[model samples]
Target: MVPSPALDTAARAVPRVRPAPAPESAPPPRRGRRAAVVLAPAGLTLALGLWGIRRQNSMWRDESTTYQVAHRSVADLWHLLGEADVAHGLYYLLMHGVFTLWDGGLLALRLPSTLAMAAAAAGVALLGHRLAGPRAGLAAGVVFALAPAVQRYAQEGRSYALVCAAVVWCTHLLLSAVTHPRKRTWAGYAAAASATCLLHEFAVLAVLAHGVALLSARLPEPLRWAWARAASAVAVVLAPLAIVSQQQASLVGWIDDPGRPELLGFAIPALVGLGCAMAPSAAAGPVPLRALALPLLILPGATLLAVSFIHPIYVDRYVLYSYAGFALLAGAGLEAALRAVPYPKAGAAALAAVAVAALLPYSIQLRTPQSRLDDPMAAARAVRELTRPGDGVLFMPARRREPILSSPGEFRGLRELALARHAVPSGTLHGIELPAPRIRARMLTVQRIAVVMDPPGRPLDDTPQERMKREVLDRSFRRCAEREVRGMVVVLYARPGAC
Candidate 1:
């Protein structure tokens, strides 16, 4: 109270203190909101996948193989893998477990694919969010769910969808590892990559993309070394499978060189993805996300396509995981466009409308019987309607037996003229074929024969047995009727007077 005048003057000169600015690194809002954004796309994918999961009343040729293989006992499956379809052995084993739990019907068979697709959708969203933002993630996930190709595989009973899911999550894990550079994160990445390759050996191509991403990131030396170690481990683990599958590569001998239209189909989407990744977007953070997305989207398909010129091993389904990268790029592009528009919400709505409009017709067509190469059930029914109890059924080329194999009940009374052993007994996707002499002899004994064949103009099977079948049918029988199913021809041949 009695302080000197000098002290009072000093107190008056003191500057006022300001409150501390909010911490720039305050913990992010509870992750629940972000999780919701990612989960929403997953939910959409699940709904779309499940909508017509069981609608395709019949299994196609490939699904028929799955059905035949999955229905076999574990011992038989193991034995079959040693002889054929080693590439698909793991998937067949998985389906065996699924069927064991619930032998409900096609629903049980296809549900796993549907669920895997949904998981892939969610992974795409999360990966997009990590690279770009929430909006981009959401858009990417929606785009993925609506993709006709993705939807097609999602409803099928096969391993392609699972491979896609594995690749998506593996990409996400790669992003995590690069950012954190932790042992646990890299381990997760390895596990994901391994699972992807195990689902389908072709998926090992994804690792090339991962390597590119790691190199482009320019991480610390320790992190880079860690990635190399992790990648090497994955390769070592996958080598055995790759070698075995290579021996059975003949299983894919049917895949032809892709034509101009097919190349265009693949190029268009990949170009779109690249364009999106290159586009300037503040929402898409500055780690050259394009470097990551581009390689994943383009490398696998391009490598396969190029190699196919030499080996004819290219098929779209084998590299379906590339779609995830495309979806991520598309989502980012759509979000960037929406942000640029005067009315962001309206722009987003319009974008979604355009996507739906573009996809609806194809989606509708996909649900019909004609969407697939052939409806096995339809072929079986057609054969049943045309044949008598004692008629002999012959699958020309032998592999054409898929339809009948899928609907064994329909042809119960008819003799399989050239079958030396049934698929399960023979431990083969189709079945063992009789010798040429045996086939001809069997054909001679039957008064009426029903032939299951490939469509006209398709290359005919020229095996000796097939040639003999043709010769005997032409010389001893008259063509009574012929019908064309979606992807096959059903011909009725009878003794000249009997017709």
Candidate 2:
């Protein structure tokens, strides 16, 4: 990388008229450029993550899961992972350590994601700078930081952002190994790749993307085989996790088969990435941006989507690392677009400013609790305000119990009609529920019941016990009052005219 920088610095250091070489040598200027491109977007990402760090003190269903799981005893967490969410076990363990150091509620839960996203931004800058010039690198970092999906996940308390960060940095290592070709570098690549896949099993798809880049670049036989050995080692490391996660595949059973909207989602981005990659400047190097970026941008999503037809496993976040590839191409394309004009640097700055201005509305929207699918914290507040003494509680699909899982104090006054065991005890996210017959009998015992459910138009649970919950509540209890939370519903039901 040092010698590569000299190539760019040689052109810039062509005996400038007024500049002093002592203060402005190649290394110093290069160091300044590196910090400028890397830190600028990283700072912006941190700012975005911090701006609405709390989401008005709201925690969504997923974050609520993270809160409860991370707070669990290590033994319980380990046990729970085997039964479900084995793929995310590594992340849960990481967050457990995070909360151990500083259990600052939402801040503690989410700060790691914020930091991970910032790291991801820095990695994107470095990768772009290595392939193209510093301007392209700066552009790529900014593009990644400003992506709506990146912003959404940056504040999320989940493995996706960490996976994104790990994948980006690991891809950078892969590139480094292409040039440096040392045994130690390959070892680092394997360690990084394994860590990324461990964050989420689906992240192994990134290996396929890396393989494509290696094939397309037409590197020497030794380098190619080294990547294969490294990739093979990563696969070996992840094999156990893959097997475990497959057994837990029901965790993602909620995903629908890919439809027109889903097709369009990948198609639009694929076309744009292809266009940007075709630009002559974007594809100029030993490992050109297009050679890597096109495959990285397309392969993961395409593979996942193609596999989704057989197993229904496609989701945008599952392939979130693909966004890094898109950002790289876009940044290079932006620089190429401006290359024909005079004062290209000025043009790039103006374009970046315009982009910030254009995306202002979306940036503001990303901070709100409403931006998420559901806010369990808001739903908890609804449950707290509506419950009466001796009232029974029910979660329509059982998983709707997410609101009170982290804040069990709210469960104190209300008796849970269907619960047979608590989450930690049962090794489940939502507590296990009684059979349909028992649930029916229990619902009849309470004078009033409070039910937590999904928003209207969301799919209902088709399980028999869930059906019985709805049937008994509707037939035996009359709706007294109801309120809508950001992403869920809370309804109070009374026996006969008790309301």
Candidate 3:
């Protein structure tokens, strides 16, 4: 059959009607690839974070406090926060929920931090990708997951790792708002920033870094103004929490002036970050990335350290979020170095090998019980062995009560001679102490007493109650035995000649 000449001519003229090559769309597939690139690093981070997470079956003093506080009834937690640790109230609530689901010992206690650290690594990768490229992001995330300080906190059962994760995401959200100025984006920025601050009041310092990012950004006037508004909103939302945390500032009285070694330790990361920012590849990346990363790396810790000269509020873990910036900068530096080399892929593999080799010893150390200042579990075990039914336990200087609090079961049979109330009842980390006269009176009555004290050379706590406790013990009792436990001393005293 012969087709009509007009129809045949039209079909030939239509160029075979090839369906427009499927509209050249690959959005879904492209998105899926991007998600894989981001998530693979996150998964690696999670695996690394969970490694040796039990920390050799040891619990430090602070973790013990976390365990005790988180295990409390919700009503008791609320009451306790009113008197102390208002700074950690939200974290305690989160941990309480975690323990409620699975009270599976240290694993449950430390898992939240491990997960938070993994999230932080993912955010670091995303930030690096946004600033530079995917390779840089992956490298940064890997570096962060391997950092000694990061690994240390990842295994700790505390709010610092959570704060680090929140601040990293907040930085990412700030970048998003800068790039796409919309009400929803700005609101998301505000929420992320607020969450960071709420996680730990010290994390509010990260806002200064965000300000640096905004100021350096080449965004339009309206976007800049929107950022300012968002920053103000975050500040306004967190004001009450700041005020409450400040009221509890005395809790940090134990932080002494950072020594030379500590200062040098902090300087290493800051110097490395600054060097990366000043490197040639730093110019190749988005200008705002260097601006953002540099300030985030240096400002929080530097500001805290400078202020500590007058008020002494500096603690390394308090500014753990700064490490994220260090990771990003290190990633950029490595990429820059590799780009300059003759063979980039080989260069990258070599650099990574060097990093792992350098960090291996420290990584191994981080998993040991001696990694911490002292093992509260060890002290508690010693106390348990020394104690007898009806004997009294006395915490010298009051703060030494940490071991007892950590292993409450071990000390259950012994009376707490100076305790005014239990921690939950007294709304304190260590229960409130009885009056000096009462402490002395109780010490006199006990036929045998176990004393938990700090190692010698720790400046003596000269409070009236501590003085009274020493006076009574010296006058009425003779030392029967003294045992040195890691980070503590346990001494047994009995009525003269009773030993």
Candidate 4:
């Protein structure tokens, strides 16, 4: 059977039913706009990232962990990883290099995440343009830049943004391999998938997403097997990290099993992604948006949430790359919507304005400290002003020591009453504290103590150590000066007559 003479020489026969693939349904030409389409949203993301990069110079609990851990010497970092966060070893090493080159404090800490999110926006735009059109691509990129979740993680010091970027670009690479069918392309895809899984093991979920995409596209059997081989290679390469990180899973024991709110979170956005994915695309590529975006948007989050019932590793940020798929669908949906309406250009402009108006308040809120669960800097200020020389400070649950650890010099004048070993040397998040008897003995000698505690009504830790701290404080000391700061309760305790 001879190939159709009208089929372009460059594009391969991706499907037996179709004559050609990539160029078959291309929209009317305004060529050479691909670079601009990718760069535009990326620039917007970078601007949004830099707009309030400092978050009023406040770092939250996780950011504090990143900052302090990344600053450790290589030996200390490696040793610490063996004990605490082996999953984050690569990210910590990357951050260590960033800090070594430029000690810009908060700026250095979070800039990598911001830049990586910008890259993700670029990837989304390129993908949207390939499937829908330049307009859809540009819109998708901008939407990604403005997404509240994207904005939230973009300003943090973490690996999720980088993982998001890798997933988005690798998805684009998957489509490229489908149309072009080159060993180099598949190799790139496998390599990227491996790197993404290395960044965080949860990204293996994206591999399952790609499988859904390939099956849904109904591509040729050869293509499916090729993808399978590539995916298998990724899984094999990731096996070591997966095995090692299994031990680390217990580190996130704090995560609760998915509940009603988790269901609502996945269900609502999932419906929207589905609608947009099913909408018509004016510019069509080799792959269908429904086949690609819907699975990418739905599978990772839903699977992880479901798995949380057994292992409890679900986190919204862990599947942050899902937003790229949503952005792609949204851009295509907007384009299809405008095409359906009269006076398309006017509808597009009006839609853009409406989106900006609706998102402005949330955008403003994203730049503030209140956007996160808690701000450590707010409590650090209280600690700085309250402590006098010769005072002793006690972190009731030990993890409450985060604010002082974040701001190294803040606790200078006060002795750490409960700590037996410092965090860096002990290779722990918070330093190891004394046994219950030792803590009680230390407390008995202090005339004045500053007790750092969690906010009211959080469940108590049922350990002997906590029982000792509470009983000794209640029995021997009088609360003198008490202040409530963001995420913390700082109280001054004194011997019965000292106050």
Candidate 5:
């Protein structure tokens, strides 16, 4: 049908309607200032941590293991992959690449770990800021930097620091994404979480913690969906590593039980460490229960205690991530207590004073004898100086023995290998790996010397602690010279020319 002339004219002359402009939320002008404030704590913490690491002792046993494993030939390392510690394959490969560029000395070996710990402190600060505010971040960062446990691990060459860093950053990103439901934040959370898992398997605990945090906060459905999606992505990426990690699960069953007293002592010391780290001594000592929230302390303390009883899977290093939570709780508790007093600033000032007082003493303590980890290089030097051509070396237990004696880090199958390469013909013996009869017979025939890392003592029974101690030492030799070098105890010995 043909349109009417009037209708056609009306349509042609159509009304002019303007589309509405999209609404724009004003950008926060003080955002930059707030960001600086939020990050200030983390930055200062990182700086202090770096400084402490510079002044810290050299690499110890675990660090040594990292270097040796990393330095091994790819073929040899591949063979090792089928053995124990397939869980650490990626970390070993990464460290191996790192050691190739630099001599695996103390500084070179530990640089990566130092950086990792710094990153972890920053992540803790970010988490605090997101959970509370910039002030909370500041408190958390400073406390984290000064944290004796963090300093101890950061200064060493190990995977814990790296794993801790990943946990913190991933936690922060996950929380932010869940709180805001942004694709960028979700993406970041997924990536960080995956990296954390690669660095250490225990990092999966952060995911569990994140879930708890989200549920506690009652996050929105859309945000939860985003978080779940990010989590799924991380799980997918980590599947292969998970499969490989299964190969090392057998080690879990071997974890020695810390007796009741030992467990309690460990728990108390850990809590005290946190108190000393976060609160000023004045505050922690005079008014710890009040200054730090009782509920905050009680909840976690109970959880850890329960974990010890239920699963019995407790280690100082594994629960290291809990430090972040403790720091946050400490800051909040301090803030809450301060708010209760007549003058908020006075309470804060008093708490700050206490924090400084508490930390200074422990920081001094850390610089002293308590921080000593190991000494392999000096021991090696001593052995080398004493040994003549064709002299033989023997370790009573094999698992803790390595050729390179300078550092106390993990031997990574390198102790015997290195000694053989550098000091061969003058071979070494590890009783644990080699049959005791063969080792004894070999020692009887050769110009044999024994060096035990521990003090002079008889071998213990085949209990876990005794085994661990025995394996770590070289026995069946007498000390010729004992000296302390770089916080390590070195002993020299020599066997009869022909036994």
Candidate 6:
């Protein structure tokens, strides 16, 4: 049949159909670009983190302790672990392995911690991404990587940095598993949590914090059940270690409770510290309090107070996990605050200014060894200079018996300096040698006896040795020479015949 005009128009207008858009292609994620943007700041933070790796006070007493314990033979370390520090034996063992390749100087001893700080920075980034968004994660990582406290420990020869790194990673994995419970995520959580415990006993508190954060999310029963299983597995694995090191329980005895005022002081600054931590370089002004409010300001401070009331053990540094919390909160706050300002760029500039300003003092302090710690190397040098062949150096008061008598804790550097200088007979004086009569008699034969004192006071007089030295030895020998160096008094005594 002949087609009508309307039918003809309809046939001509008809078109072939095509497939619909394929799920919008997810807008290309922009993940790479976002990561690049975040990484720029993170890289700066990492640079700053490693900036003063060697510019610390000569290894302090605590650092010396780490070096001494870690450098022992494996068998020796095992034998001494229970007596010395069972709690940190694993850390010493790990560091011991690292020391085999390099001598245990400040740099070599602290290198692992520096690397651990870098890993922590990476964990911060991953955590920020997982907790908030990619931007938050980036900022958090940058903040953590550049934090003064983190940098401080990162450059020190201790286990705190490694513990910090493990905790950060464990938190990251923990939050991930909480958000999406699966076999793989649970496995990661277990591994990270296990490592955290191995790194430091205090890390258990951080696991508790993770539990709190997770419980806040209100996950379903299945996920919760799975998480419980994973956590239980970790506890099972770590219980034996904890039992073996039960002696560590005594270390907490010396801990004093922090009062409200002390808590407030620490809490307030910890928040500010977060801002300085996130910013690449700080400004020349104060850090904003807003940035420190969440994890930094309230959570850590409050948690510590709560822990103190319940467990009665609260030391500031022991809550190093609080540092990570501060970094995260600061990053989130800075990002949020910057977004709210009229000019994001200007806000960023202002924030950057404040961050740099705040960081300057800490940076300078970190770079100058004497600024952060006593000059142990100088003390060692002083000891070396005072020693002569066949001359015996005695630490006064007997109880002060150590390499320098004034500072025994810097044993690592002290011993190294002693070995390098070939100064033999560097033993500490016995308590018995301090008797006035004994000291005077010994000086008669030991003509070159040198006396070193701390805080500069006259010799003790209670002992018979002191009376004899004052009555008899004082006339026999003149006070030949004395000088003060690095907060110590060095007095040289020469016999009358020798003089």
Top-scoring candidate (lDDT) = 2
For candidate 1, the 10 contiguous residues with the lowest summed lDDT are 280-289
Q: Across residues 1-499, which tens digit of lDDT does each residue of candidate 2 receive?
A: 3567868889887976895557444467778888999999899999999998888888888899999999999999998998999989999999999988899999999999999999999999888988998988998998999988899899999999999999999998898888888999999999999989999887888888898888998878888899989989999999999998889888888899999988988998889888988776744457988888888889999998999899898999988889999999998888888897898888877987898898889888888887888887777778888887799988887888888897778767888999999899989988799989999999899999989998888888899899999899778889988989888899999999798
lDDT of each: 0.85, 0.89, 0.84, 0.86, 0.58, 0.61
- Inter-residue clash pairs, candidate 1: none
Candidate 4 clashing pairs, residues 3+ apart or interchain = none
* TM-score for each predicted model, relative to the true structure: 0.92, 0.92, 0.93, 0.92, 0.71, 0.72
Q: Which digits, one per residue and each the tens of the lDDT, describe model 5 over residues 427-491?
A: 21111244444444555454334343443453434644334323333354445656554434435
* Candidate 2 structure lDDT: 0.89
Which stretches of model 5 miss by more than 4 angstroms? Answer: 1-29, 52-57, 73-75, 182-187, 232-243, 249-254, 260-312, 339-350, 368-373, 385-389, 403-437, 456-499
Best first by lDDT, ranked: 2, 4, 1, 3, 6, 5
lDDT of 2 at 333: 88
TM-score of 3: 0.93
- lDDT string for model 1 (1-499, tens) is 6999998899999988999986776645647657876899899888888887766687788888888788889999988888788888889999999989888678988899999999999999888887887888888889898888999999998899999998888887877787777789999998878877888888888888878766776656777788788878888988988898788878888888889976997899988997888676544432456767788889899998999889888788889999988988888888888888899998888878888898888888887778898877778888998898999999888888887777788998998899898877677778898899999899899899999988888887789988999899989999998878889888999998886
Instruction: Pick the winner on TM-score between candidates 2 and 4.
Output: 2
TM-score of 5: 0.71
For residues 104-185, write the lDDT of model 4, one tens digit per residue. 9999999999999999999999888888788889888988888888988999998899999999988988988898999999
> What is the overall TM-score of model 4 with all chains considered together?
0.92
Number of residue pairs clashing in candidate 1, backbone atoms closer than 3 angstroms, sequence gap of 3 or more or interchain: 0
